[model samples]
Target: MPRNRPLAAVLTTVVLATLTAAVTTAVTTAPVAAGTAGPKTVIANLFEWNWPSVGAECGASLGPRGYGYVQVSPPQEHVRGQEWWVAYQPVSYRIESRKGTRAQFQSMVIACHAAGVKVIVDAVVNHMANTDKSGPGWAGSAWTHYDYPGTYQVQDFHHCGRNGNDDIVNYNDRYEVQNCELANLADLDTGAAYVRDRLAGYLNDLLSLGVDGFRMDASKHMPAADIAALRSRLSRPVYIVQEVIYGAGEPIGPLEYTGNGDVHEFRYGKDLARVFRDERLAYLNNFGEGWGYIPSNVANVFVDNHDTQRDVPGTLTYRDNGIYALANAFMLAWPYGSPTVMSSYEFTDRNQGPPSDSAGRTNNSTCYSGGWRCEHRWPVIANMVGFRNAVAGTGVVNWYDNGWQHIAFGRGSAGYISINDEDFAVTGRSYRTNMPAGRYCDVIHGEKSGSGCTGPVVTVDSGGWFRADIAAHDAVAIHAGARIS
Candidate 1:
């Protein structure tokens, strides 16, 4: 769900103002899971992309680039508005919104599956539309604040009689955080069996239509036990990643929800940004557990998501340009957590939705032409997907950093990468890795073409040493999968 303005201010100031250390001393990294149906664990968050655009991207880019999953914004019918947050304010579970009609959404799923990519929906189950407004939803379903004709009723919500408006004001109190409204949006009584069944039914509907998984939105507002009950109601097991923002000293943290499934490691993007902008890139050598984040296996990490791109202060967004690409390159090269590459559209206003018609139907995305900033398609980010897949199950080795903005590392003998964030070029440096001797494409700058590369190529000698000059804020990555000879 997109962050609400009023609530965003509170969350930015109170909950996420401080970057705290990891809450638990968990395992460093979980062993990579055995092969599954999808290509890999890399997810492309195509936020606000229409269903047709999503389907086309599957065949045109996602499949070719080795993306395992694509997470779409909430597909349910939403309030009538051009603001992006309206998608988060559900009026009904109908699969009709500015994104597309239900048929179009189903087609997108089929196309993605055909392309060997799984679909993960951003499921908004914690609340309904803001109680203040009432009208026909996007799908023509008449809905009031707490009442949907064929879905939920007033009793399905939690009228937490705290703060005058019932909106969450105290992050320290677990009960208030879970039961109170978030930005005055009607909070669902998730603990209630009836409400849980309704939410599960909506998710099951998506599964029936071939959705492979779900990104549980606003999971922090629901107790872990309640979420488990909702999961139990699922028709079958589907991949689940819950959004449990880790607030410092908060009673309920992201770790508590790991039992349910993978949790969004919010700290990753923030800490990563801090290192890229203010701290040293060498510090990323001890990025994950050393930085006190959640266990790598059950953590879902991203450089910047839709919300953080606008609301969070410390993270990097598309505006960072080449430096942002370098950050993503490092993320893909580093075996930290399951990485999600965020593909966003240009937005001058926080509430501005994707490019849409007068009636609010989203237009087809014209990458790099219209508002779409297809970051996932960027050379450094897209090509690195293959690098990540090639280095799967391999641990970091031959790590090196210049004690500041330059760092290099290898994943066993499968892949190697060196990122230089210094203001000037670091020339004539020979970086040693465990990769086999061969002519490999420098995936960061150019992709592998037939028998060669389109950009600068790096040759590793028999002794596993590669000599190259890295430019300021640039990177060079070579993987076994892209070896030319």
Candidate 2:
């Protein structure tokens, strides 16, 4: 298990003061490229967002909400198309795509860094574009099927063919899964030194532009050795969480790539979704390893990703506003793996792009307008970000549940939360907390302004308890950071 790192300047609280004096210092602010993550650290995946809009969001919301990093869409040149999948296909390593130009990409990095937020780009090194798609791509770079000008040649890609069309049809075979074409997209032969060098150069260029890490696309298709080789060439290890979706019976597993970095845990989302939607609140008392998931430090957990929201059945999404917010609140409040909040725009079709102007350029997102759901901006979810940060490094404490509808817990003395998931409401229920006697703002209901709370206030007595009556499908959350007096 990875130990939680202490913050540089700890929050000036009685508990934090003692934690600070533990004396053995740890990692912070040096880019979360690779290591066991701290509890306070959370990254938000801003899928399909362009540069200017992302920069604005970094300044307006992300940094203030305590997000340590933002994983953006692939910024390299890709097929000049509107569909979201176009980003996963590459035309060249040139930092030019629908998101923005190289200059705009650099500017966005600078802007995010100014707000103390790091940028982790979605690095699609697994494949080039399909042969059917001829490319004078988004940045006007002309290319043929296997020839990327000034970089990869036809020899750089694998020609493995088990199926007649060279597509990967056998998931059970390791060789076929790694070397064959995925969805008929051109697969790169990542093992060759020439191929490794070109891939490393592309990532190193991003590093020069102040990128902190990468979300390795199709990492399951590439050997762990190939990724480790690519990382060895870099000056230092950067955060690299691979997209390797493996369950109980998969041939290849996430352990294969842990040497390189972390993997975005798909199982974590599926497990939580089942209990929350079914209103099985009792099973959650033992929510972490008992439910079968990766450990807290190594796993990058989320409630839903861009793909799962559209394709995966029974997964909670922004459409399920009441239920989805409830799940997100649970994910944040629980001391599980390092969490990633999904901040995405709304889409009816699976292939729809962001809201665009007449010229097909992505319009600046107004979030609530322009089809952007912007769940990160929701008051309940936004305030929970601070709640999670304040309670960093603390274990779950004072766990209380009514065996069905209501469940309440504390994070040492830093925070406390009670969730009511049943159809009926509960009134004036006394709940135990670990916090000292004081009135705290329930951040999920509203924010604490100046000396007043915009939400309901909970006053914990000298004995560390409070009485709160929450409605069905509602939650109550309070932390020491928001204590008004």
TM-scores for all predictions: 0.92, 0.90
Against the unseen true structure, what C-alpha lDDT does each candidate score?
Answer: 0.85, 0.79
Candidate 1 per-residue lDDT over residues 36-106, each given as its tens digit:
21238899999999999999888777877788999999999999988889999999999999999999999
Over the stretch 152-192, how does candidate 2's per-residue lDDT look in tens digits?
88899998967998899988888998999999888999999
Q: What overall lDDT, based on C-alpha atoms, would model 1 receive against the true structure?
A: 0.85
Error of 2 at 166 (Å): 1.4
Best by TM-score: 1
| Cα-based lDDT at residue 202, candidate 2 | 94
Residue 414, candidate 2: Cα error in Å is 0.7
Which clashing pairs does model 1 show?
22-292
Cα lDDT for residue 184, model 1? Answer: 93
Please report, as a residue range, the 10-residue window in candidate 2 with the lowest summed lDDT.
27-36
Give the number of the best model, judged by lDDT: 1
